[model samples]
Target: MTILSDIPRLLPEGMALGPALDRALAILERAGFSAVIYDYTPVPRSHDGSLITPNILEARRVPEDMLALWKSGFYQLDPVQDAALATAAPFVWSGLGKQSRVMDEVIRERHRPVLGYMHDMRFSFGVTVPIHQPRGDLATFTAIRIDAEPDFAADAAEIVPQIGVLGQIFHDVVSAGFDAETRRTHHVRLTPRERECLSLCADGLTAKEIARRIERSVPTVTLHLNAASRKLGARNRFQAVARAAHYRLIEAAPAA
Candidate 1:
C-alpha cells in the first residue's frame, strides 16, 4: 500500500498546471480521498474593497453547482473559507469545533436556501490545508472523502505535514505562469514611513495609537497611510495594509 509519506515523490515535474494537478490528485485519491480542490487568492480583496472569491486553480470530482455558487458570492458564507483565513495550519472540517457550530447555525438561520448543499453534494468529510505566503496571501488545498470510515480523521492527521508541503508546491507551480503584468502590478514599492504605518496597522494599532507609538502626529500617520494606499492602488486602509503585506513592504507581525 502506498502510504502518505510517498506522496511527495509522486508529484510530476515540468508538466502543465492541469496535468501536474491531475497527478497530485491521483495520489490523494489513492490515499482514500474521493476528490480534491485547490483554490488560490492572489489578491484577497477586489478593486472595490470587498474580499475576493478564491479562484479555483484545479479540482477533481467537485460539483459544478458548488463552483458556480462559490463564484456567485456564496463563498462569503462558506465556513471552510472562514476557517482557512483564521489559521495557518491544516485542519479537518469535521473536527473544526467552533467553525462546525457556526456553519450549522449559518445553515439553519442565515443561509437556509443552501441548507442541504453539503449533504446533497456528498461532502461530509474533508481536510483543508491553508498555505501561508510570506506576503500574507492565503491559498487553500482541500481533499474530500465522502462516506469515510470512522478512523479516517485520525489516519489523515498523520499526513497533514505532507499535505501542506504538496499544497505549497502546487501553489508555486501554478503561480509561476502568472502574466508579467500581473506580477508587476503586485510588486509596488513603499517608502519607509509608509511601510512603518502599514506595519503598525497590521499589529492592530489604531491611527492615534500608531501616531503615539511612532512619535508622529495623528494627521502625519494618516497622511502616510493615504499615500501607501494610493501607491498600492488600494481602495481603503484595510486593503492598503493587505497589499503592503503582500509586497513585503511591511511585515505582518504583531507589535512586541
Candidate 2:
C-alpha cells in the first residue's frame, strides 16, 4: 500500500497538529525513511510573539538530542530553516566534515548550533515540504533517514505535491472546525421551546403543525422559529435549517 492509503485512517477529530503529522511520519518510516517533521506556521508574528508550533513531536526512531534541540528553539536560528523560509525549495545537506555548505554557515554564524551539533551525532537523509496556507501561513514536512540509508529527496519530490493537495483539505476541514468552535463558544441561549420549534420547522413542518405536535399555539411556534432564525443570522426558515445542519446543531434528518 502507498502512503496515501494511510491518510484516511490517520486523521481523527480534534488535536489537529500532532496526531495528523505523526501519521504522515509513520507512513514515511514504513517506506524506509527515518524521521519526519511537519511544521505549520500560521503567521510570522504570533499573538504573543513566541514561536507557535515549536517542535510538536519527535518520533522514537529519530535522534533523541535532535528532538531536544528542536524543543529548545534551535530552529529559530538554523540557517537552513531561514533559507527554506526565504524560499520554498528543498535540497540535500551533505556531511558537515569540512563540507556541507548549509551546516558550515549555520555553525560559523552560531545562529543555532543545533544543526551543526547534529552533524557529529546522526547522519540523516531526509526531505522537507513547505506547505503554504491560503491565509498565508507556512507549514513544512521533513522526513529524516536513519544511518543515511533512505533517499528522502527522491521520496519527497514524489510526495510533496501529494501533501500539497492534502494541505487544501486540511485548510478546509480546520476552517470548518474553527467556525464550529466559535459558534459553540458564543452559542445563543435559546429556550427549549424555541429549539424544538426550530428543529421541527427545519423538518418542513408548518408553524401550525409544529404547534399541534409540541402543544403550543401557532403564533407561539412562529415566534420561536422566527427568533431562532434571527439568532442564527439566517434570513428565513430554510436558511436557518441549513446553517444549523452545517453547525451540527441539528441531526441530518431528511426533509419531509
Candidate 3:
C-alpha cells in the first residue's frame, strides 16, 4: 500500500514535531523512501532579517560537513530555497540549469560537494512541498529518490497532504509554546462554567442540550460557549472543543 494510505497506522499518538517527523519519514521509507527532510524558514525577525530552520535532524543523522554548511547559512543562497520562498504549493527540481544565473555560482562553487554526493549516490530527482503560513513564513518537505523510478514521484505525491497536516500541527505547537507531548499533561485553567459548557459541547451537545444538562437556559449556554470561544480564539463550537482537547481542558469523549 502507498504511504498515504498507511498514515493512520504510522502516525504516533503525540503531536510533537520530532515524533511527527520521524513517523512521516518512516512512512516514506516503508513505502520505499530515498531521503526525506522537512525544511522550515521563518521570515527574518527584522526587515532585513535572516531565515531559520530549527535543525530538526539529529547530529548523527546528517553528514557533519553538510550540517556545518547549513549552520553557516550557505543554504540561504540555494535556489531551492528561493523556489520554496516564491510559492505556497509543491514543486519539483531535478537539477541546476546552466542558465539559472542567480543560482549557478552558489551551486557550482559552494553547494556542489553535497549535490555531487547525492548525484553519485544515485539520488536523482526530488519533490519539495512548501507549507506557507499567513505570516509570510514557509516550511518545506523535500523527498528525494535514488534511482530512475517513474512512479516514485506519483507515489510520493500521495503522502504530501498528510505531511501538510503535520506541518500545520507543527506551527500550532510552536505558536502555543507546548508540543503534543507537553500538551497531554497541560492544564488550561478554565472556569467551572466554561469547562462544563465545553465538556457538553464536545459530546455533540447543542446549546439546548448543554443548557438542559446544566439546568441553564439555552441563551445562557450560548453565552458561555461564546465566551469560551472568544477566550480560546476559536471560530466556533467544534473548534472550541478541539482546542480544549488539545490543551487538556476537556476529554475526547467529553463528560456524559
Candidate 4:
C-alpha cells in the first residue's frame, strides 16, 4: 500500500507524458523490474471481437524489434492482451512456462510464435496490468523483470494489487492531456443526434418510439440511425446500436 502511495509523489510536477512515463519506469525499477511498456488504445476491439489498431504505444528498456512487431499486428497474437481483456486484475506471466488452459490453448492453437519470440529475447518474466477506462479505452501497463530466478512469478503475483493502483494512477495523469481524442477515433464519429438516436435504439425502442421520445419525425430518426450505422461500419441500425454500445459511444443500459 505504501509502495502505491509513493507513486504520486514520484510522478512529474505537470504530469507530462514523457517525464511521467520516465518516473513510472523508475517506480517499476524500484519494484524489481527492468523494462516497461505502456500502451493506450482508443478502440481495442469491435463488437464482433476483431482486433482494432492501437493509437499510442510507449516503452522503455525494451528491444526496438519488439516495438516494431507490436505495431505490425503482433498484438493480435499476444496472450497477455487476450488475458487482460478477460480480467481487470493484474497478472504475472512467464515467457517460458505453461501458464493456464486458456493461455496454453491460445499458444497451441495460435500464439506459439509470439511466446517463442519472448523466450529468444530474454524478456521472459513479467507482469501486466490491464487498465480499462470508463469510456472504453484500454491502457495496459507492463513491466518486465529480465533474468529473473525461479520464484519471480510468485513475488510478482503477491504485488498485483499495488501494481494495479500504480498503473491506474499513471494512466489517469497521462490521459489528462487526451481530451481531444476521447469521443471519436479517426475511423469513426457519431453526431450528437446520431448518438442520441442510438442510445435510444440500444434501449430497445422502435424507430417510431424513438422518434416520439426525442420529439423528432420518424424519417429524421431514420436518417440519424442510418448515419450512425454508416459511421460505426455496421450493416444496419441493430448492428449500429450494438457496436455503439460496445464502443461506449452510447448508453448501455438494459432495455426497460
Candidate 5:
C-alpha cells in the first residue's frame, strides 16, 4: 500500500515537466480528487502589487470552456487562488454549506460566466496546498471533488495536512524542467555584495553598520541594497531584506 506521503517517491523519474505535472495530477487523482489545478509563478507579485502571469499553469478535469476563460485572465480573479496566496498552509473550502472562505471578495460581474460554469460543472468542494518555494516562487496544488457532499471538507481533514508534502515534492519535480541558471537568475539574482548587504540588513544591521563591517562607504552599501531591492522587485530596502530571507538568500536573524 502506498502512503499519501510517498507520492513524491512514487513520481516517475526523469520525465519532462508536462509529463511530470500530469503524473502529479494522476497521483492526486489516486488520492481521491476528481480534478486538480496546478499553478506556478516564478514571480508571483509585482512591486505595484498586482498578479503577474504564471510561468506554468496546468489543470486536469476542468471543463475546456471555463479553462479557456480562466486562461484569458480570469485566473487572476480566482478567490481560491487568492486564498492560497494569502497563506502557506493547506486548506479546504466548499461552494456550499457555511461558506468556509471569502468567495465573493474578488467576484465581479465579468467573472459570472466562469462562476456559472463551475456551478454547472459542480467543481465545488476543494482542498488546496500552497507551496512556497525557497527561491520565492509560489505554486498551488488544488484538488477538487466534483459533486461532493457538504461533508467532503470534514472527510478531507484527515488527509489534507499530509497532502501538503505531496505539493512540496511535486513542485520540485516541475521546477526541475527549467535550466538551472535560468531558475537561479530569472527568479531572483543577487551579487555577493548585494546578498551580503541584504543578509546584514536582515540580521538587524543598519546601512552604516553594513558599510563598516564590509569596509565600504555608506553610499556604496546603500547602492548595493538599492540594487538588490530593485532586482528583488521590492519597494524598499526593508522589504528587500524580508524578500531575501523568504527566498533563503539570507538566513533568519537569530532571535534576540
Candidate 6:
C-alpha cells in the first residue's frame, strides 16, 4: 500500500494544480485505487445571487464520455454528490442509505438515465471524502476501484480515512494555487469580534443590545458588524448575519 508519509512532497514549490493533482492521484493509484476525482464548490456568497458552478478540480482515469455527461448536468442526479453536499464526512458510495421512500423512488425512476449511464461506465464502487469549508464551500474527493476485487469493500473501509486526509491535503494545495481573486472568493475569515456580533445578530438582538451584552460601546459593535458584513459580502446587518450563519462562522440560531 502506498503510505503518503510526506504529502507535502507531492507539491513542490511552483507546481501547478494539474501536476500536483496528478502526483496525488499517483499516490492513490499506488494504494490500489484505479481512479480518482476531486470536486470543489466555491463559497456561494461570491456568486452574487447567480448560479454557483462546481469545479472539477482534478480527475484521473475518468472516461471522456463520462466527464462530458457529468458536465452536461448528470451530476445533479448523482446520489454521491447529494450526499457530499449534505454531509462533511468520508463515506463509501455503497454505504449511503436512501433519504426516504420518496427520494428512493425518485432516484430509481426519475434518475434512471443517469443511473444507467453510471452503471455502463463500470464505476460501481468507490469511497468519497467530503470536505466542508467554514465558508460554505463543499468539496469531495473520490477514489474508485472499477474492477472490484473480493476485498474491495474491505480495503475501502480501511483506507477511506486516509483518502479523507488526502482530500484535505489536496484541497489545501489546490487552494494555495488559486489566484488572489479566486482565493478571496472561496475563503473568508472573520475576526472573533465580528463572529460574536454576527452570533448576537442571529439571536435577533439589536446593535445596542449586542453592545451591552458584549460590554463594548455601540459604535465599536457597529464597526465590527460593518466589517463582518463587508468580509461576508453582505449588503446589511441582516444579510451579514445570514451569510455568517451559512458559512458556519456563527450559529444560525441562539441557544435556548
Between which residue pairs do clashes occur in model 5?
none
Pairwise TM-score winner, candidates 4 and 6:
4
Sort order, TM-score high to low: 4, 5, 6, 1, 3, 2
Residue 112 of model 6: what lDDT?
62
- The alpha-carbon lDDT assigned to residue 122 of candidate 6 equals 65
**Candidate 2 per-residue C-alpha lDDT over 1-256 given as tens digits, one digit per residue, 9 for 90 to 100:** 2556645566545535555556655666666666665544434323232333331233435656666677567656555455445555554443332323443444446553655565765645545455555544555556565555444445545664555455444434333344433323123345567767777877778888998998989888888888878877888889887765543456545754
Q: For residues 161-226, what per-residue lDDT tens digits would candidate 5 score against the true structure? A: 766777777677766776644343234768889989998898889999999999999999999999
Kindly give the stretch of ten consecutive residues in candidate 5 with the minimal lDDT sum: 95-104
Which whole-number lDDT from 0 to 100 does residue 226 have in model 3?
89
The window of 10 residues in a row where model 3 has the poorest summed lDDT is 96-105
Among residues 3 or more apart in sequence or in different chains, the pairs in candidate 1 whose N, CA or C atoms overlap within 3 Å are none
Task: Give TM per candidate.
Answer: 0.61, 0.49, 0.49, 0.74, 0.63, 0.62
- lDDT comparing candidate 6 with the true structure: 0.70
Segments of candidate 4 deviating more than 4 angstroms: 1-5, 12-14, 98-108, 134-136, 149-158, 183-231, 251-256
TM for candidate 5 is 0.63
Q: What's the TM for model 2?
A: 0.49
lDDT value for model 4? 0.77
- Any runs in candidate 3 off by more than 4 Å, and if so which? 6-9, 44-46, 49-64, 95-122, 147-256
Scored by CA lDDT, what does every candidate get? Answer: 0.69, 0.55, 0.58, 0.77, 0.71, 0.70
lDDT of 4 by residue, 80-105 (tens): 78887777778767787647444544
Query: Compared with the true structure, what per-residue lDDT tens digits does model 3 show for residues 75-191?
Result: 544555665666666555554212223333223454555555555556555566666766454566666566747766666557655545544544454434444443232223467
